[model samples]
Target: MIRKVFSDTGALAKAIDGFVPRQPQTDMAIAVDAAIRDQGQLVVEAGTGTGKTYAYLAPVLLSGKKAIISTGSKNLQEQLYHRDLPLMKSALGYTGTTALLKGRVNYLCPERLERQISECHRPDSEPGQLSQLVKIREWSSYTESGDLSECDALAEDSPLIPVVTSTNDNCLGKDCPSYEDCYVVKARRRAMDADVVVVNHHLFLADVAIKETGFGELIPEADVMVFDEAHQLPDIASQYFGQSLSSRQLQDVAKDIHIAYRTELRDTRQLEKVADRLSQAAMDMRLVMGEPGYRGNWRELQTSPSVEKELVRLSDALDLAHDVVKLSLGRSQLLDAAFDRITLFKARLARLKDTSITGYSYWYECTRHHFSLNITPLSVADRFREQMAEQGGAWIFTSATLAVEGDFAHFNHRLGIDAKQQMTLESPFDYPNQARLCVPRHVPETNSFRRANKLAALLGPVIERNQGRCFFLCTSHQMVRELSALFREQLSLPVLMQGEMPKQRLLAEYLSLGNALLVATGAFWEGIDVRGQALSCVIIDKLPFASPDDPLLKARIEDCKLQGGDPFAQVQIPEAVITLKQGVGRLIRDQQDFGALVICDNRLVTRAYGATFLRSLPAIPRTRDLHHIDDFLSGSDTDSNTMQSHLLDQPIEG
Candidate 1:
């Protein structure tokens, strides 16, 4: 049955978007089906052009199993839930259901909206804050899922956002007044009954680590869990397994206390005083930390006395405030929510007070608006393994880059997986003919101070020849910011950076612009899918290594060294290979996709460790000459034109 479906995947591809099918995609479907049938673990390295979404979805839906499909980004989750699942359902002629569920924070809380609106009538209300609140109230009437993404006008970092969404600490669940009409409850109810469910990695990891009572438990319902971008799992799991507190979290706590107090408390003056004290303490904490993103682990932080004193005051204020608020007169949903939030906040502070967890690294990340205290585990392998065993399901982990030198040991060691059952699905795209890896003849070290201007001068003609159709990726945000300034000065094309706009809006603009260039950091390297002519070349700046001085990486390396292991090769090289492969995967998204990958760092050609990075890539042709690079780009231009014309002839599908 699975073979028949794979053979007929051509029809599935055409049903939704006029997509062309590839043999690798079909073979992957077969392997995934076996994993599901046998109820075992499977790790697959599906290359860029493998059509992974449909390949996995077809088998899962066809099997009629309650499967959880987790993607790496919101964009991919939305696409799979809204775009690919419907097509897979249609082509397989199945009538079962599908649902999309994000974390609790993604959905709006009806209780929050009511309390916020009532508090808006106070004399101290900001001029336009109420209007934005009203706008959200109006939008909520027709919003189905209550997911914030439906509100196109709302900025993600808006002050008004906390007024609408509920955090884990504040969510009252069944105790909420609007429990019957709650969006999160309704969405999860649908997911519990649906044949297939889609979620991002955050929600999946949150469910694994948190296991909060009342609403946030997600486990054992599905027989199998498919992790789409499994390379990102280790990093995400580390964060979720740890604890973090931000100014945003503290501010939300204060705001909720106000809403609850105004509605119920007799002595609102004392409530107001305590709330203001906590808010001021949070601000002072930020002020004491002078620079943005000034990071230091707890051991290093002990040397600073002023910051430590402020943190102690903040914790005491929260403790006193929680006591004062609970002695209120009336009871409402807001009161219950505020009480829970206070309890949770105090517990989190208690966790942050300790820096002696044997296998954890405690640190703080400071910014302009707030400072975040983090306690991240040095190794999440054991914790993740326990979560996996507790969940008790067949696990399938797939990504474009999971293996190094055709070995999955590094990935397995980090995630605590023994991948005796594994598959490597190579791209069916003709990489040797369609793609070329190029290194400039006179590439300089990325560390050189003059390299910024030198790189722009060298790549200006390359971008011009390709008509400004390029993606230049770098290892750090500072480097990208510098290159963006340099390129805008030298190049005539429209240049865009990551932070200039929202990620999706920027990507939409990049698509609309006929030929444009982008210089971005690691965030753009993966989970971005752009096909056809517009994205024909990807240029990387360095070997993408983590600095040994970085707090978390340093702690991790120390642990590795203490265990008598080679930290550079064991931990660093494999991690870099995974990142470099993600950047290179941007080009050649499809079979007709022809492009060149240019590396401006000469280490890939001159250093001995270069072979590891090279072997991690697909079997694409390579060169170290300027002439060969030009020839490949020229050929790509011709192929892109022909492919665009062909697409115009095909029947368009939405």
Candidate 2:
């Protein structure tokens, strides 16, 4: 049945335009169908252009069963729910309801909106916040889903978002006057009744954590669970399974307490004093942590005299606020919410104070104005396995880059999945003809002081020749800034940096500028699709290796060594291989897409592990000459084609 649905003259090809039959897609569909029928575990690596979304969706839709589909990000969740899933449902003629369920923060909370509007009317309110609130209030009258992404008037990075959304710590749950009209409650109720539900990884992990505590769950139980972009599960699961307390959370609780004192319990003078002290204490901790935008070793910092003193001060301030809020909890719903938040914060702080625990990373990160102390477990394998057993459903994990060097050992070890079936389906794109790979001569060492300048000098002409449809991917933010600055100085095209705006806006601006170069790190490496000639080249600064100073990586390294394993081979290289594959996968998104890849790290040729990275990439034509990049991209030099064909015949090696 699954194969017939994906065939050349099937229902999908007849109903959907540009629907060509793909064997890889059909194979994946059959595998998913069997997994769902048998209630088994499966892992699939469906490469780019394999149409994995429809491959899994068709089987799940045709099965006539309840399912939960989770993606890696909110954007993908929205895309699947709003775009892909609808198209598949229509083409396959599957009549079953589906719901797009996101975290509570994505929905507009009427209670929070009302409180913010009331607060905005105060004389000391910010100048533009009230007008923003007024615009959102007007939109709220007609918007059914209350998803804030639909509010065109609200900026993506607006300060008003946190003021107008509900978190677990701040939500009044069933006790508020607006509970009957709550958007979150309505969304969850719909999700409970829907045949299929779409969610993101964070929300799925949150549901798991909540369920473990015997509390209610956000996501409904289903007969099957499909995790798309499953490569990110281990890292995200660690966060949910561990404990964390951040300055933003602390300050948010403090603000709520002050609000309760002002509007709900005006006579509680002690509430006001303790709120101020708590806020100040949180700020003092950030100050004592020194500079921002860096992670610190909390294990070492805990014993320092200055940090220890501030920790005690912050604990005392929290205790004082908790006592004051406790005295008047029943007097105000807001006060009661604050009391619960303080209690949670106290418990988390007490857990974070314990540095004697094994198999966890004790770390703290500081932004410009906020800080977070976290304890993440080195591995989430056991917890994740236990959750799957409890859920008792067919489990399927699929991603473009899940398998490193044609093996799933690292990923399986991290998540403790012993899948009953596994498959690696290559993308059907004509990569040897569509893409060219370059590891140019005289590449600078990664640690060279003049690396950025030399790279600019070498790649500037090639980028200019291609007329600036390039992405200079980097391994670090500092590298992003450095290369972006150099390209701006050397090239005439518009240079866009990542942090300048939101990611979608940045991509829109890149497309709008037609011939622009985007320099980015992290998020840009994956989940970004720019088909056609708008994005033609991707130049990576170095191999995408996690920093040695990273706390999580450090913990994993220690744990691997303790288990008598080679940490670099088993942990670091495989991880970097997957990341490099993602960065390269960004170049060719469609069958018709053509591009050039330039990897600037000499380690590929100088180090033995380089073969692992090379063999993991697609079968792109490789070259070492800069002129070949311009020639291949422009189709100017016929000899370059011959060179490409010859290189394509050779096996990838160090």
Candidate 3:
């Protein structure tokens, strides 16, 4: 039945435009179907163009089982829920219900919206905030999902988001005045009743680790859990399993207390003073944390005189706020919530103060006006395994880049998965003929000063020749900024930087321009799907090795060393290989898609570890000559056949 669904004459072929039958998609569908039937564990790496989405969706819609499908990002979640699922439902004629659920922050809280609007009357409200709130109020009358993404007036990173939305920390839950009309509650209820609930990894991990009373019941109730982009599970799980306290969290509580005193409990004047002191303490703590964008060793920083003093003051402020709010707790629901938050803050501060614990990365990061103290466990394997056992259902993990050099050992070890079935299906694209892999002959050293300028000068012509249909992917944000500036100076086509605009808008601009270059880091490395001629070239600045200064990576390295293992070989190399493969996968997304992959770093040819990266990537024909790259992109390579034979027999070596 699954095979026929993915066949040339299948329902999918009729419903989905340009659907082609591929053996790998059929095999993956069969594997997923069996896993669902037996309630077993399975891991499969379905390469790009393998139709993995339809492969899994076909069985899921047919099975009549309650399933939770989690993707890597909310963008993908929206796409799956809004676009792919509808197509699949029509194709298979399945009648089961479906719902798209996200973290609370995505939904509009009627209580918050009302509170914020009432507060907007204050003379000191941020400029333009009122108008934005007014726009939201107008949209709220008819919006069904109450998803902020649907509100066209609001931007993704607007400061008003926190003002109008609720978090786990601030949500009043059953105590909220607007409980019946709460968008979050309504969304969760729909998810509970739906046969298929779509979510993202962050929400899935939150459910696993938090298990909060009312909001965390969705994942555990499902019979099957499918994690797409499963490569990102370990890092995400680490964050949820760990603990964190942010200055914004503190400031939020203080703001709530102030609002409560102003509107609900006018007699409690002490609440005003306490809230001001608490907010001041948080700002003072951030001030003492030194420059922004700094990730420091929390254990060391806590001992510094200034930080120590601020910590004491912050604790005192919290205690004082708790005492003040305690007197008027019953008078205001908002004050009661604030009181609970103060107590939770006290507990979290006490826990963060303890640095003697081993097997955890005690670290802190400071932004321009905020700071966050965090402690992440060095290993989440055991915890993840325990959750899987407790949930006890068909657990399926799939991604295009899960295996390193045809081995899943690194991935399995990180997540502690002992799957009964594992498979790696290569992408169906004709990579060798359709793609060109080039490590230019005269690339700058990875560590050189002004390396960004050098790379821009070197690859600028190639990008120009391709008419700016390129993605300049870098390992660091600093590099992204530098390259964007340089490209804007050198190239004539549209140059879009990641932070200049919202991500979706940026991508839309790229597509509409038809000849634009996008320079980005981190988020753009994976989960970005741009097919056809819109994206034809991907230039990577360096091998994406995790910085040695990363606190989590540092902690894991120490643990590996203590266990008598080579941390560099065991941890770092495999990770870099996986990341490199993902970046390379950005090219050649379709059978007719042709592009050039240029790695600006020479280590790919000069270092021994480079072979691992080479082996893990798709079999794209390699070349070092700039002329060959230009010819490949222009369809004029006279030596195309010879170059393929030569490069396939023996790739360029140092």
Error of 1 at 594 (Å): 1.9
> What is the C-alpha lDDT profile of model 2 across 1-654, one tens digit per residue?
888898988978987888899999999999999999998899999999999999999999999999999999998999999999989899888899999888888889898888878887879988988888999999999999999999999988878889899898889988998999988888888888899999899988987875531123534369899999999998899999888999999999998888878787778799989999999999999999978879878998889899999999999999998888888968989889889999999999999999898989999999999999999989899999988887777999999999987899899999989898999999999887888888887778899987999999999988988999999999989888888999999999899999999999999999999999999999999999999999999999999889999888898999999999999999999999999999999999998898899999877866778888888899887877778888888977545356564352245443
Steric clash pairs (candidate 3): none
Go through the candidates in order and give each one's C-alpha lDDT.
0.79, 0.89, 0.89
TM-score of each: 0.92, 0.97, 0.97
lDDT of 1 by residue, 1-654 (tens): 766565535556447555555678887788788888877788999887687777788878877888899999887899888977877788888798888988777788888888777777889977877788788878889999899888875886666776687767778777777889898888888888887889899988887777762224446778888999999999999898898888778877777677656777645678777888888888988787667856777657745798788878899888888887787625656666666777788898888887777778877787768788888988889988876777676788999889898888888888898655777788778886787777777777777878888888888888878887799998877788988999998888899898888787788888898688988986799988889888988999888898665778888888999999998899999999999988998998877888888888767756778778877888776665656667668863334333332221133222
lDDT of model 3 at position 119: 91
lDDT of 3 by residue, 1-654 (tens): 998888889898898788889999999999999999999889999999998888899898899999999999998899999999999999899889999999889988889899999998999987788888999999999999999999998888888899998988888989998999988899989998999999999988887888762546777788999999999999999999999999999999999998998888888789999999999999999999988877888998999999999999999999999888898878889888888889999999999999998989999999999999999999999999998898898999999999998899999999989998999999998886788888888889999889988898988999999998999999988898999999999999999998888887888999999999999997788878899999989999989999888887899999999999999888999999889988988887878788888888777777778888888998878877777888888888745475775362365644
Better of 1 and 3 by TM-score: 3
Quantify how close model 2 is to the true structure by its C-alpha RMSD in Å: 1.9
Cα-lDDT of candidate 3: 0.89
